[model samples]
Target: MSFRSAVMAEKEESTVEMEETNTNSRAEDEELADGKEDGLEQEEVECANLEEGGGDGDEDEDDDDDDEDQIDNESKKKTDQDKGKKCVPGIVYLGHIPPRLRPKNLRIMLGAYGEIGRIFLQPEDHSVTRKKRKAGNNGKNFIEGWVEFRDKRVAKRVAASLHNTPMTNRKRSQFISDLWSLKYLHRFQWCHLSERLAYEQTVYHQRMRTEISQAKRETNFYLASVEKSQTLDRLRKKKQKKGEAVQDKSWDFTQRRTEDEMRLEKMKKKGLSKKNLQKAQEKSKAIQEKAQSNVSLLAKIFSSGRSKD
Candidate 1:
């Protein structure tokens, strides 16, 4: 073969090798770039996943806070209701207790035993009333009040535990051992407003006003007429000691009023005659007994008639 042909062959082979190397280098560069791009893509995906996971955790935390707040509110309301002790159905209506039994220390002592609803220290309004009442026996003071509990069982336990206790602090402390088991109250009822007794109070006031007015007028007239009348003549002469001889004819002017006269005047002013009061009381009692007997007889007749029918 010619030398030129050989040289051309060698140059062509070298050119071919250079071209292949260039192509292989380009392929390697593309593969490396692809690998880097794949790594970057993976990192970005991981970042996105991390952000999503963190957001989910934050949402869960928020939900947990809401649940906790709701529970707290519910518990607070329930606790308040129990503490307030709002009386409703199934509450007790214990009868009026006497004021002297535990006037000052009943509540203080009873409260320590259990959660009492209220210690109503007023009289019950269970009687018929009028518009205006007189201050008399009909004026009831609800000296008794009831205690309420959240649970009926608790109420029973408290009630059963409060009776016959030493309810005083003056050398006497009431022991509440017996009052913890009281039960059987359907519901509690309290009296709020009662009408005043009209008729009895009217009569009492009218009579008093008339007597006072008449007495005042009579008193003024009596006081004024003393100077005009010969009061000296009517006045009883007082004797100087029985054994002494009287020499002076001049009478003592300082004889304002005898003890007897003053006592008579006081009696009249006060309208105080025991005989008169006794007679009046007897008449009233007689009338009451007669009316009661008549009522009893009528009731018997009605009952008999109804039974026959």
Candidate 2:
């Protein structure tokens, strides 16, 4: 009976010890699960923060693109405004352009004064050009010119200062001794000059056409007169060859009475009165009767003789 009681106490002690060990192992497993859950939550928070930062960078790039577009639009507007602006130009007339002075040289010389816009140099006359070319002088010459200036005030000032002055100070220059004859023309535009040139060209062409027509008409008339003269000559030669008497019919116009004879006749009429005129008529009648008696006696004698024979 003592041995069985001792065995029961040992079994009870061993079972209590096993129950405490199982409780400790369960507590350790719960701690491990909590630690793993905390690590997962930290990783998720970091990923969300990185996504928000990336979204902010994309928004900053969009803002930069919008700013660049606005800048471009403003610049385009400024360029358009500049293009819409207009400027009024002025003109200067040159009375005489010297020899060997070309438009290029003129521009180079005058560009020092102000901004030059348009330049026109009238060429020398064609006849003069031909003569010079024949003489072995082939250099181009300008008769007159017109220059455009950006500003009216500058044009006026240049014209005033340069008139009657030497063209240049350089002694070796070809135009050193030449004088400037400049005049500022008010209210003159380039269009007016163009119109004038066009009109002159049209007039020149019209005159040329008229001259050619007149020359052709004169030539035709001359040819016709020559042909008529030749035909008359040929007819005269044929008549002579055929032994025909070519009677030339000439018309003689009566001569007009002289003023002196008319005056003398008028004087005689005025001097004779009505009485003298009747006396003259009676004497003329007596003379006519005597002449008729004589003629009748002669006819009687001639008839008697013929009868006796």
Candidate 3:
């Protein structure tokens, strides 16, 4: 009976050990499944973040495109404004305006035809101011002026009909002769005039500078000047000889035939048809004779009447 009881106890111990091992394995499997599920959820969250970032990047690109478009539009508008400012149409230039004519009076005369926009009168020359002042002149003689019209059509009409027409101003109710000398400036702009004036001034200054430099040049020695003068004389003689040779070659009057001479020769060779001309002359002579006879008869009748009176 004792042996049977010990074997039963061993079997019971083995069964309990197997049950603990099985429970530990089940707990480990459950933990591993929970970790896998957490990893999957993290991956899904990362994918969602990547999608949202991609959308933001696309939105940024669209905003950049819109900014570029706005910039382009603004640049175009600026270019248009610049073009409009540079090319001003319907502007006319009136030159040689009478200095006595004030801007107000000029507008009054021109305004009869059209609306005036701007007027520019040439300024009095400062270099001549002193001379003019000494001559008892207030520098109000005649000034060159320009007039701008508002409408191009009105400017054209006025320029056509009013060019070279005389202008007159009243003085104490006496009728003064008008000397209207108006000219239409074609394709002439104020800027062009300013440019020309600037160029002329530059040229004048350069000429003055050159003249001063030339005057300041060292004088040549007497012997050297004599030699130079002799050389110049020789050159002049050579030029004269060359000119004479050229003249001799160009105009050999002995052989040259003028158009009139050539035509006379041609007519002599061709024998002109003078029959029609002779007929015309005879008819004219007959008419003259008839007129003279009529006049003489009228004169005789007048004489007879005078004698009777």
Pick the TM-score winner. 2
Q: In model 3, which regions exceed 4 Å deviation?
A: 1-88, 91-95, 123-130, 168-176, 216-309
Q: In candidate 1, residue 212 scores what lDDT? A: 100
Write down the TM-score for model 2: 0.55
Cα lDDT for residue 284, candidate 1: 64
Question: Which residue pairs in candidate 3 have backbone atoms (N, alpha carbon, C) closer than 3 angstroms, thus clashing?
Answer: 166-180, 167-179, 167-180
| lDDT by residue (tens digit), candidate 3, 1-309 | 999999999999999999999999999999999999999999999999988799888889999999999999999999999887662435555666655667777788888888888876776666677788888887554467778876666777787787766654566522144455556676766678679879979998998899887766634455678898899778778989778532332655567787555655665677766675456557767887888788878989999999999
Our model 1 lands, by Cα RMSD against the true structure, at 22.6
Please, what are the lDDT tens digits per residue for candidate 1 over residues 153-225? 5665555665444334355434322232234365443232112335546876998899999999999998878
lDDT of 2 by residue, 60-139 (tens): 99999999999999999999988765456889999988898888999999999999999999998889999999999998
Alpha carbon lDDT of residue 105, candidate 3? 76
**RMSD in Å for candidate 3, one decimal?**
20.6
Ranking by TM-score: 2, 3, 1
lDDT of 2 at 116: 97
